[model samples]
Target: MARIVDVNPALVRQRAGAASEFLQVAEERLEFIRAESGESAEAQVAASNAIAAGISAADAICGKALGRRANDGDHRGAVELLDSVKPGGSKLALRLSKLLSDKSQLQYGGYCSAAVARSLAREARKLVEAMNEFGIRS
Candidate 1:
């Protein structure tokens, strides 16, 4: 059984800041796919993965901040992390939970669409920005 660890506020804040940076970069890549490409299927898939990675990383940091261990298993891990964070609510967490759940569906089952990927990325950006608002600092 995995256990949640109580982390220092300063460390949590630092982790949140790091997660925000990574997520920002991921969002940028997703946008680059839009600006550099014509929203191709490959671009959409790439964007989806990028955002997923960003969310995964972001959730991991937030989870740690909130006294949870965001592990692997994608969506399941995300949900567990959210639960660890008290009431478990955040736009980024919600969006990520959804996307992480269907990532295999998008990648293997070909459900990834340019519009959907872009939307997910946008949501993730908002979440990361929100984390910054929560006193995350370098």
Candidate 2:
């Protein structure tokens, strides 16, 4: 069984700050995608990376507030951890799950369209917002 440990308040604040920073970068990348009219692997990869960065920001927030870090190798583990923090099958959990599912295809192999990339960016924004709210709640 995994146990909840003590997280330093200073660390929590630091993590939250980092999350905010990442969210900003993710938003900027999303904007860049919006400015581009056509689809490209580079755009897809950027969108995917932005989503991953958003996830990382959320993970940092959850770790600080919940005192449990997600397993590095398992994206699902990160989702589970976020769920633990938010509970009740929250939208945040659902969005994270979807984004994680899309992440691999966007990053590695598969066809990623402009629409898909845009959708991922929107989801990433939502997740980042949720993380920000969670930080406030904590």
Candidate 3:
């Protein structure tokens, strides 16, 4: 039988909202790259890398919130734990996310593109700002 569990709706909304926003930003960047560069192999690769970085950040933030909720015995509310967290590791996550993905390849043979770097850098800035607004630091 499925048990009806009481969960904090606010928390759930916050976590989901943050994650969704992160994903949205990544997608926006990808779309822009595609529209501007068409099917150029290098452009496509760069876009992929940038999107991957955004994914990494989103994953890190969601993973941490979920972990915290689990440790606190709030399984039902785990999906909404972002609101309860004070954005502590978000900055590090943002920076690491970009570096771990496409940013590191900015100087590669077919990777050094002004547009790609700009997009990734801009996304990183947006993420940092969002994390800060949520009180995330690191």
In order of appearance, the predictions have TM-scores of 0.60, 0.71, 0.31
* Candidate 1, superposed: residue stretches over 4 Å from native: 1-18, 31-42, 53-61, 83-92, 107-111
Off by over 4 Å in 2: 1-18, 34-38, 87-89, 136-138
Model 1 error, position 45 (Å): 5.3
- Tell me the TM-score of model 1: 0.60
Measured by lDDT, the strongest candidate is: 2
Taking the tens digit of each residue's C-alpha lDDT, what string does model 3 give over 33-130? 54443344545454544444443334335444443333232322322333344554445454544544553344354544446645664664454355
The TM-score measured for candidate 2 stands at: 0.71
* Per-model root-mean-square deviation over C-alphas: 4.3, 3.7, 12.4
Ten residues in sequence with the least summed lDDT for candidate 2: 1-10
Candidate 3 deviant stretches above 4 angstroms: 1-39, 68-117, 124-138
lDDT of each: 0.55, 0.63, 0.44
Candidates 1 and 3 compared: the better one by TM-score is 1
Q: Tens digit of lDDT per residue, candidate 1, span 76-138?
A: 655556644433355456766665665666666643555666666666665565554444554
Clashing pairs for predicted structure model 1, backbone only: none
